[model samples]
Target: MGKVTTGASMSIDGYIAGPEESGFDLLFQWYGNGDVELPTGHPDMTFKTTKASAEYWRSLIENTGALVVGRHLYDFTKAWGGRHPMDVTTVVLTHNPPADRPLADENFVFVTDGIEAAVAKAKEIAGDKNVGLNGGQIARQALDAGLVDEIGVDLVPVLLGAGTPFFPSLGVKPVQLEGPISLIEGKAVTHLTYRVKK
Candidate 1:
Protein backbone atom coordinates (compact mmCIF):
# COMPACT_ATOMS: atom_id res chain seq x y z
CA MET A 1 0.00 0.00 0.00
CA GLY A 2 1.11 3.58 -0.49
CA LYS A 3 1.05 6.59 1.79
CA VAL A 4 -1.88 8.99 1.72
CA THR A 5 -0.95 12.66 1.60
CA THR A 6 -2.42 16.15 1.07
CA GLY A 7 -1.15 19.55 -0.02
CA ALA A 8 -2.87 22.93 -0.08
CA SER A 9 -1.96 26.57 -0.54
CA MET A 10 -3.40 28.48 2.41
CA SER A 11 -3.37 31.98 3.89
CA ILE A 12 -1.82 33.12 7.16
CA ASP A 13 -5.25 32.70 8.74
CA GLY A 14 -5.42 29.07 7.48
CA TYR A 15 -8.07 29.72 4.88
CA ILE A 16 -7.83 27.89 1.58
CA ALA A 17 -10.69 29.87 0.04
CA GLY A 18 -12.13 33.27 0.76
CA PRO A 19 -15.56 34.34 2.02
CA GLU A 20 -18.57 32.66 0.37
CA GLU A 21 -16.23 29.88 -0.75
CA SER A 22 -14.70 32.41 -3.15
CA GLY A 23 -11.96 30.25 -4.70
CA PHE A 24 -8.23 30.40 -4.02
CA ASP A 25 -7.51 33.02 -6.67
CA LEU A 26 -5.87 35.35 -4.18
CA LEU A 27 -4.18 32.65 -2.14
CA PHE A 28 -2.54 31.24 -5.26
CA GLN A 29 -1.45 34.61 -6.59
CA TRP A 30 2.06 33.21 -6.91
CA TYR A 31 1.00 31.18 -9.92
CA GLY A 32 -0.85 34.01 -11.62
CA ASN A 33 2.17 35.67 -13.15
CA GLY A 34 2.53 33.11 -15.93
CA ASP A 35 4.26 30.59 -13.69
CA VAL A 36 1.45 28.03 -13.70
CA GLU A 37 -1.90 27.78 -15.37
CA LEU A 38 -4.65 25.94 -13.53
CA PRO A 39 -7.62 24.27 -15.26
CA THR A 40 -5.40 23.91 -18.35
CA GLY A 41 -7.31 26.26 -20.65
CA HIS A 42 -7.69 29.68 -19.16
CA PRO A 43 -7.59 32.59 -21.57
CA ASP A 44 -4.41 33.86 -19.89
CA MET A 45 -2.84 30.50 -19.22
CA THR A 46 0.93 30.17 -19.27
CA PHE A 47 3.65 28.06 -17.65
CA LYS A 48 6.88 29.68 -16.55
CA THR A 49 8.55 29.01 -13.22
CA THR A 50 11.91 28.74 -11.50
CA LYS A 51 13.51 25.30 -11.65
CA ALA A 52 13.01 24.72 -7.93
CA SER A 53 9.37 25.78 -7.89
CA ALA A 54 8.61 23.82 -11.05
CA GLU A 55 10.16 20.76 -9.52
CA TYR A 56 8.17 21.24 -6.32
CA TRP A 57 4.86 21.33 -8.15
CA ARG A 58 5.90 18.66 -10.63
CA SER A 59 6.97 16.33 -7.86
CA LEU A 60 3.48 16.44 -6.39
CA ILE A 61 1.81 15.80 -9.71
CA GLU A 62 4.25 13.17 -10.94
CA ASN A 63 4.50 11.34 -7.64
CA THR A 64 0.78 11.06 -7.13
CA GLY A 65 -0.80 7.94 -8.61
CA ALA A 66 -4.36 8.68 -7.57
CA LEU A 67 -6.28 11.65 -6.16
CA VAL A 68 -9.30 11.93 -3.85
CA VAL A 69 -11.34 15.14 -3.92
CA GLY A 70 -14.59 16.51 -2.49
CA ARG A 71 -17.71 16.96 -4.59
CA HIS A 72 -17.70 20.71 -4.13
CA LEU A 73 -14.19 21.00 -5.53
CA TYR A 74 -15.11 18.64 -8.28
CA ASP A 75 -17.93 20.94 -9.29
CA PHE A 76 -15.95 24.10 -8.66
CA THR A 77 -13.39 23.27 -11.29
CA LYS A 78 -16.06 21.90 -13.58
CA ALA A 79 -14.45 18.53 -12.88
CA TRP A 80 -11.37 20.14 -14.36
CA GLY A 81 -13.29 19.91 -17.60
CA GLY A 82 -13.39 16.13 -17.08
CA ARG A 83 -9.59 16.04 -16.96
CA HIS A 84 -7.79 16.74 -13.71
CA PRO A 85 -4.67 18.85 -13.72
CA MET A 86 -2.50 15.95 -12.50
CA ASP A 87 -3.83 13.53 -15.07
CA VAL A 88 -4.00 10.74 -12.48
CA THR A 89 -6.77 8.46 -11.36
CA THR A 90 -9.22 10.68 -9.43
CA VAL A 91 -11.87 9.46 -6.99
CA VAL A 92 -14.53 12.05 -6.17
CA LEU A 93 -16.34 11.62 -2.83
CA THR A 94 -19.98 12.53 -3.23
CA HIS A 95 -23.44 11.16 -2.50
CA ASN A 96 -24.46 11.94 -6.05
CA PRO A 97 -22.25 10.15 -8.51
CA PRO A 98 -23.26 11.88 -11.74
CA ALA A 99 -26.08 10.23 -13.60
CA ASP A 100 -23.71 9.63 -16.51
CA ARG A 101 -20.11 8.74 -15.90
CA PRO A 102 -19.24 8.72 -19.56
CA LEU A 103 -19.35 12.50 -19.60
CA ALA A 104 -16.08 12.50 -17.74
CA ASP A 105 -12.78 11.01 -18.83
CA GLU A 106 -11.88 7.47 -17.88
CA ASN A 107 -9.48 8.70 -15.22
CA PHE A 108 -12.26 10.08 -13.03
CA VAL A 109 -14.26 7.85 -10.67
CA PHE A 110 -17.09 8.97 -8.43
CA VAL A 111 -17.32 7.13 -5.11
CA THR A 112 -20.73 7.67 -3.56
CA ASP A 113 -20.26 5.47 -0.52
CA GLY A 114 -18.04 7.76 1.63
CA ILE A 115 -14.59 9.18 2.29
CA GLU A 116 -13.18 5.85 3.47
CA ALA A 117 -14.35 4.12 0.35
CA ALA A 118 -12.87 6.86 -1.77
CA VAL A 119 -9.53 6.58 -0.04
CA ALA A 120 -9.63 2.81 -0.32
CA LYS A 121 -10.30 3.04 -4.02
CA ALA A 122 -7.58 5.62 -4.45
CA LYS A 123 -5.09 3.43 -2.58
CA GLU A 124 -6.12 0.46 -4.68
CA ILE A 125 -5.49 2.42 -7.82
CA ALA A 126 -2.28 3.95 -6.52
CA GLY A 127 -0.59 0.67 -5.56
CA ASP A 128 2.98 1.57 -4.55
CA LYS A 129 2.65 5.27 -5.30
CA ASN A 130 0.93 7.86 -3.12
CA VAL A 131 -2.77 8.64 -2.91
CA GLY A 132 -3.25 12.41 -2.68
CA LEU A 133 -6.18 14.07 -0.95
CA ASN A 134 -7.02 17.12 -3.07
CA GLY A 135 -9.49 19.04 -0.94
CA GLY A 136 -9.63 20.41 2.61
CA GLN A 137 -12.74 18.54 3.71
CA ILE A 138 -11.57 15.24 2.26
CA ALA A 139 -8.14 15.76 3.73
CA ARG A 140 -9.72 16.31 7.12
CA GLN A 141 -11.74 13.14 6.68
CA ALA A 142 -8.63 11.13 5.87
CA LEU A 143 -6.70 12.68 8.73
CA ASP A 144 -9.51 11.90 11.14
CA ALA A 145 -9.65 8.34 9.87
CA GLY A 146 -5.90 7.95 10.53
CA LEU A 147 -5.23 7.36 6.84
CA VAL A 148 -3.11 10.39 6.07
CA ASP A 149 0.67 10.02 6.09
CA GLU A 150 1.63 13.62 5.40
CA ILE A 151 0.17 17.09 5.32
CA GLY A 152 1.80 19.78 3.23
CA VAL A 153 0.91 23.44 3.21
CA ASP A 154 2.16 26.18 0.94
CA LEU A 155 1.67 28.96 3.45
CA VAL A 156 0.93 32.21 1.70
CA PRO A 157 1.47 35.53 3.52
CA VAL A 158 -1.96 37.05 3.04
CA LEU A 159 -4.71 37.08 5.66
CA LEU A 160 -8.27 36.45 4.57
CA GLY A 161 -10.25 37.72 7.55
CA ALA A 162 -13.24 35.45 7.03
CA GLY A 163 -13.19 32.48 4.73
CA THR A 164 -13.30 28.74 4.49
CA PRO A 165 -10.71 27.36 6.90
CA PHE A 166 -8.37 24.67 5.70
CA PHE A 167 -8.36 22.66 8.92
CA PRO A 168 -11.81 22.63 10.39
CA SER A 169 -12.66 20.96 13.68
CA LEU A 170 -12.28 17.20 13.25
CA GLY A 171 -13.83 16.57 16.67
CA VAL A 172 -11.14 13.99 17.36
CA LYS A 173 -8.04 13.79 19.47
CA PRO A 174 -5.18 16.02 18.50
CA VAL A 175 -3.07 14.77 15.59
CA GLN A 176 0.66 15.27 15.76
CA LEU A 177 3.03 15.97 12.88
CA GLU A 178 6.81 15.87 12.77
CA GLY A 179 9.66 17.14 10.59
CA PRO A 180 9.03 19.76 7.99
CA ILE A 181 10.80 17.80 5.25
CA SER A 182 11.49 21.03 3.45
CA LEU A 183 10.71 24.71 3.89
CA ILE A 184 11.20 26.44 0.58
CA GLU A 185 10.85 30.16 0.98
CA GLY A 186 9.43 31.75 -2.13
CA LYS A 187 8.65 35.35 -2.88
CA ALA A 188 4.93 34.75 -2.37
CA VAL A 189 4.69 31.51 -0.42
CA THR A 190 6.54 29.23 1.97
CA HIS A 191 6.17 25.52 1.42
CA LEU A 192 5.95 23.42 4.58
CA THR A 193 5.82 19.67 4.69
CA TYR A 194 5.19 17.54 7.78
CA ARG A 195 4.88 13.82 8.30
CA VAL A 196 1.77 12.78 10.19
CA LYS A 197 2.62 11.04 13.43
CA LYS A 198 1.08 7.62 13.62
Candidate 2:
Protein backbone atom coordinates (compact mmCIF):
# COMPACT_ATOMS: atom_id res chain seq x y z
CA MET A 1 0.00 0.00 0.00
CA GLY A 2 1.23 3.51 -0.72
CA LYS A 3 1.91 5.73 2.28
CA VAL A 4 -0.57 8.30 3.58
CA THR A 5 1.08 11.72 3.95
CA THR A 6 0.20 15.00 5.68
CA GLY A 7 1.82 18.30 4.69
CA ALA A 8 1.66 21.81 6.17
CA SER A 9 3.63 24.95 7.10
CA MET A 10 4.25 26.26 10.58
CA SER A 11 5.74 29.28 12.34
CA ILE A 12 8.44 29.88 14.97
CA ASP A 13 5.71 30.20 17.58
CA GLY A 14 4.68 26.59 16.84
CA TYR A 15 1.64 27.76 14.94
CA ILE A 16 0.76 26.22 11.64
CA ALA A 17 -1.31 29.33 10.85
CA GLY A 18 -0.91 32.81 12.25
CA PRO A 19 -3.22 34.85 14.46
CA GLU A 20 -6.66 35.17 12.83
CA GLU A 21 -5.03 33.72 9.72
CA SER A 22 -5.94 37.00 8.00
CA GLY A 23 -2.24 37.19 7.18
CA PHE A 24 -2.16 33.49 6.49
CA ASP A 25 -4.22 34.19 3.37
CA LEU A 26 -1.19 36.16 2.26
CA LEU A 27 1.17 33.23 2.76
CA PHE A 28 1.28 32.52 -0.96
CA GLN A 29 0.38 36.14 -1.68
CA TRP A 30 3.85 36.54 -3.12
CA TYR A 31 2.93 34.37 -6.09
CA GLY A 32 0.10 35.90 -8.08
CA ASN A 33 -0.61 37.40 -11.52
CA GLY A 34 2.12 40.04 -11.77
CA ASP A 35 4.68 38.49 -9.41
CA VAL A 36 7.48 36.23 -10.58
CA GLU A 37 6.43 32.73 -9.69
CA LEU A 38 9.31 31.23 -7.77
CA PRO A 39 11.39 29.03 -10.02
CA THR A 40 10.39 25.38 -9.90
CA GLY A 41 14.08 24.60 -9.31
CA HIS A 42 14.10 26.74 -6.19
CA PRO A 43 14.71 24.57 -3.13
CA ASP A 44 11.63 25.91 -1.33
CA MET A 45 9.34 24.60 -4.04
CA THR A 46 11.02 21.26 -4.67
CA PHE A 47 12.52 19.32 -1.79
CA LYS A 48 14.74 16.87 -3.72
CA THR A 49 17.09 17.35 -6.66
CA THR A 50 15.49 14.64 -8.77
CA LYS A 51 11.94 16.02 -8.44
CA ALA A 52 10.43 19.41 -9.20
CA SER A 53 8.29 20.52 -6.22
CA ALA A 54 5.13 20.94 -8.25
CA GLU A 55 5.65 17.66 -10.08
CA TYR A 56 6.55 15.90 -6.85
CA TRP A 57 3.43 17.15 -5.12
CA ARG A 58 1.30 16.43 -8.17
CA SER A 59 2.60 12.89 -8.16
CA LEU A 60 1.78 12.48 -4.50
CA ILE A 61 -1.68 13.91 -5.08
CA GLU A 62 -2.23 11.69 -8.09
CA ASN A 63 -1.11 8.71 -6.07
CA THR A 64 -3.42 9.84 -3.30
CA GLY A 65 -6.23 7.96 -5.01
CA ALA A 66 -8.34 9.40 -2.20
CA LEU A 67 -8.32 12.27 0.31
CA VAL A 68 -9.71 12.95 3.79
CA VAL A 69 -10.19 16.54 4.93
CA GLY A 70 -12.09 18.35 7.67
CA ARG A 71 -15.20 20.39 6.88
CA HIS A 72 -13.68 23.79 7.51
CA LEU A 73 -10.91 23.33 4.95
CA TYR A 74 -13.34 21.78 2.54
CA ASP A 75 -15.65 24.76 2.89
CA PHE A 76 -12.76 27.14 2.44
CA THR A 77 -11.78 25.49 -0.83
CA LYS A 78 -15.34 25.62 -2.04
CA ALA A 79 -15.59 29.30 -1.20
CA TRP A 80 -14.20 30.20 -4.61
CA GLY A 81 -17.03 28.12 -6.13
CA GLY A 82 -14.94 26.59 -8.84
CA ARG A 83 -12.80 23.50 -9.40
CA HIS A 84 -11.22 22.04 -6.27
CA PRO A 85 -7.85 20.35 -5.88
CA MET A 86 -7.19 16.59 -5.87
CA ASP A 87 -8.92 15.40 -9.01
CA VAL A 88 -9.17 12.06 -7.24
CA THR A 89 -12.09 11.22 -4.97
CA THR A 90 -12.42 13.17 -1.70
CA VAL A 91 -14.29 12.30 1.52
CA VAL A 92 -15.11 15.15 3.85
CA LEU A 93 -15.59 14.66 7.60
CA THR A 94 -18.43 16.63 8.98
CA HIS A 95 -21.43 16.41 11.33
CA ASN A 96 -23.97 18.23 9.19
CA PRO A 97 -24.09 18.75 5.46
CA PRO A 98 -24.23 22.29 4.24
CA ALA A 99 -27.56 23.51 2.79
CA ASP A 100 -26.27 24.34 -0.69
CA ARG A 101 -23.24 22.26 -1.76
CA PRO A 102 -20.93 22.09 -4.69
CA LEU A 103 -22.01 19.66 -7.36
CA ALA A 104 -20.10 16.38 -7.44
CA ASP A 105 -17.57 16.39 -10.28
CA GLU A 106 -17.23 12.56 -10.41
CA ASN A 107 -14.33 12.76 -7.92
CA PHE A 108 -15.89 14.75 -5.14
CA VAL A 109 -17.56 12.70 -2.35
CA PHE A 110 -18.83 13.63 1.09
CA VAL A 111 -18.95 11.63 4.33
CA THR A 112 -20.40 12.64 7.64
CA ASP A 113 -20.25 11.15 11.17
CA GLY A 114 -16.66 10.36 12.22
CA ILE A 115 -12.97 10.16 11.32
CA GLU A 116 -12.68 6.38 10.94
CA ALA A 117 -15.50 6.35 8.43
CA ALA A 118 -13.84 9.11 6.46
CA VAL A 119 -10.56 7.18 6.29
CA ALA A 120 -12.37 4.02 5.30
CA LYS A 121 -14.20 5.79 2.49
CA ALA A 122 -10.96 7.36 1.33
CA LYS A 123 -9.19 4.00 1.34
CA GLU A 124 -12.04 2.47 -0.54
CA ILE A 125 -11.50 5.02 -3.29
CA ALA A 126 -7.71 4.80 -2.99
CA GLY A 127 -7.60 1.22 -4.32
CA ASP A 128 -3.82 0.58 -4.62
CA LYS A 129 -2.34 3.95 -3.78
CA ASN A 130 -2.44 5.63 -0.35
CA VAL A 131 -4.86 8.19 1.03
CA GLY A 132 -3.84 11.78 1.87
CA LEU A 133 -4.73 13.40 5.17
CA ASN A 134 -5.99 16.89 4.27
CA GLY A 135 -6.20 19.28 7.22
CA GLY A 136 -5.10 19.60 10.84
CA GLN A 137 -7.95 17.79 12.59
CA ILE A 138 -8.09 15.14 9.93
CA ALA A 139 -4.32 14.77 10.02
CA ARG A 140 -4.41 14.43 13.76
CA GLN A 141 -7.15 11.83 13.51
CA ALA A 142 -5.14 9.79 11.03
CA LEU A 143 -2.03 10.10 13.16
CA ASP A 144 -3.90 9.23 16.32
CA ALA A 145 -5.28 6.17 14.60
CA GLY A 146 -1.90 5.24 13.12
CA LEU A 147 -3.27 5.54 9.60
CA VAL A 148 -0.90 8.17 8.20
CA ASP A 149 2.20 6.85 6.44
CA GLU A 150 4.17 10.07 6.09
CA ILE A 151 4.08 13.84 6.64
CA GLY A 152 5.71 16.19 4.12
CA VAL A 153 5.72 19.73 5.43
CA ASP A 154 6.70 22.92 3.55
CA LEU A 155 7.79 25.26 6.33
CA VAL A 156 6.87 28.87 5.43
CA PRO A 157 7.85 32.06 7.27
CA VAL A 158 4.79 34.23 8.03
CA LEU A 159 3.58 33.25 11.48
CA LEU A 160 -0.13 33.05 12.41
CA GLY A 161 -0.54 32.64 16.13
CA ALA A 162 -4.35 32.50 16.35
CA GLY A 163 -5.42 30.47 13.36
CA THR A 164 -5.69 26.69 13.27
CA PRO A 165 -2.43 24.81 13.73
CA PHE A 166 -1.12 22.21 11.30
CA PHE A 167 -1.24 19.62 14.02
CA PRO A 168 -3.23 20.40 17.08
CA SER A 169 -1.95 19.07 20.40
CA LEU A 170 -1.62 15.31 19.84
CA GLY A 171 -0.72 13.80 23.17
CA VAL A 172 3.05 14.35 22.72
CA LYS A 173 3.93 11.56 20.37
CA PRO A 174 7.51 11.61 19.09
CA VAL A 175 7.99 12.56 15.42
CA GLN A 176 11.43 11.77 14.04
CA LEU A 177 12.66 13.69 11.03
CA GLU A 178 13.66 11.81 7.90
CA GLY A 179 14.96 13.65 4.79
CA PRO A 180 15.04 17.43 5.27
CA ILE A 181 16.36 20.20 2.98
CA SER A 182 16.13 23.98 2.85
CA LEU A 183 15.05 25.54 -0.47
CA ILE A 184 15.23 29.28 -0.94
CA GLU A 185 12.90 31.22 -3.17
CA GLY A 186 14.05 34.74 -4.31
CA LYS A 187 14.71 36.22 -0.87
CA ALA A 188 12.28 35.72 2.03
CA VAL A 189 10.58 32.34 1.47
CA THR A 190 11.93 28.87 2.23
CA HIS A 191 10.47 25.37 1.84
CA LEU A 192 11.39 22.47 4.13
CA THR A 193 10.37 18.81 4.27
CA TYR A 194 10.16 16.24 7.09
CA ARG A 195 9.17 12.57 6.85
CA VAL A 196 7.48 11.37 10.00
CA LYS A 197 9.18 8.50 11.85
CA LYS A 198 6.84 5.68 12.72
- Model 1 over residues 1-198: C-alpha lDDT tens digits? 678999888999888888888747777766654444333333334455444556677777667888999889988878776567677878889988778674235578888888898899888888888999964788878888888898889888888888877767775668888989778765577788899898
lDDT per residue (tens digit) for residues 1-198 in model 2: 666777665554555566655555445432332333334322334222222444445555566677777778777756324323445666778887666775334455667758877888777778889888864788887888777767755555665657777778785487555766334332233455456667
Candidate 1 residue-wise lDDT at 109: 84
Off by over 4 Å in 1: 34-46, 103-105
lDDT of 2: 0.61
Flag clash pairs in model 2: 17-160, 18-160, 18-161, 19-160, 19-161, 19-162, 43-183, 44-183
Q: Count the backbone clashes (under 3 Å) in each candidate.
A: 0, 8
State the C-alpha lDDT per candidate: 0.78, 0.61
